[model samples]
Target: MLKDPPITVNVFDEARVNHEMTVELAFVNPVSEILRDCSLTPSGTGLLQWEELTKLPDLMPNNRVCVKLIIVPHKSGERTLLVGFDRASFKDIKTSCIVNVKP
Candidate 1:
């Protein structure tokens, strides 16, 4: 179950901006074990918030996991937030959202 649909971010007249957001990922079936690793890749000028890589614990069936993300825009323009998720025993998933930077 995923919640909190993605939205557009507005950075007004700033060279760099940081925004905090959350994402939820859910499992459909019961698995022996589950692990999650998340990352952010920017198409333009931007960076991820976290410095270290970490894995989440196992999740049960029909359960959801929430991830905290920090988005930073290095320049003023249109940017894209590329979020990647790696799950144990599952294929990697990716999602992208648009961000508008104003100057």
Candidate 2:
């Protein structure tokens, strides 16, 4: 699992309000497992949520998938977002990201 970088958003200022941020993730499945489903879990209150994304391609052996995550932050604080996937032949895989929110 690999992520681009940490995101910073300003949500308090009325003039320059930032309500959302986008995150890019690149992952590779080394085992022979079929990815069935994928979802994102944001930590803390309703400060952040993942926007609906397109379906992920079936991850075969030694295949990589790049996904874009649109996250909406409703408050001002730092939060962590977790990305999880269900595999047909193996345990699920999970990854996380840290975001900085300025008020």
Candidate 3:
């Protein structure tokens, strides 16, 4: 049985504050409603947003888990937003993204 690979998206500097590089993650899964009560934290920054999440109605399997995050490049290097799934959904799958904010 093959497992579905993790879904990743890039965050451009334009999305950041003052072109600082920001990313908005919209995580949706088949169990989104069930995990509605769940919360997410980016790099230990604490809960971001979830109340107004746009649920993705199309998700494989009746039981699934997804995550989204908006990251801002604080420095010149690459910063990865480690997505930690709560309630023991699955192992941690991290997605690394690069943000060049050199003006």
The pairs that clash in candidate 3 are 16-22, 23-70, 25-69
Give the Cα lDDT of each candidate. Answer: 0.42, 0.49, 0.40
Model 3 TM-score on a 0 to 1 scale: 0.45
Q: Which residue segments of model 3 deviate by more than 4 Å? A: 5-7, 14-19, 31-33, 44-72
Candidate 1 lDDT for residue 39: 33
TM agreement with the true structure for every prediction: 0.50, 0.59, 0.45
lDDT of 2 by residue, 1-103 (tens): 3243222222232211255566665666665656557432234344444434345666676677766655556766666555555444434455564556666
User: Whose TM-score is greatest here?
Assistant: 2
Candidate 2 lDDT for residue 47: 42
Higher-ranked by lDDT: 1 or 3: 1
Residue-level lDDT tens digits of model 3 in 1-103: 1154243444544533233344554344433334434433345122122222333333434454444444444443333444433334544534434443443
What does candidate 1's lDDT look like per residue over 5-89, in tens digits?
2222333333345543333322232344443453322233354434323345555554555444444554556666554445444
Task: Name model 1 segments beyond 4 Å from true.
Answer: 1-54
Q: Is candidate 1 or candidate 3 better by TM-score?
A: 1
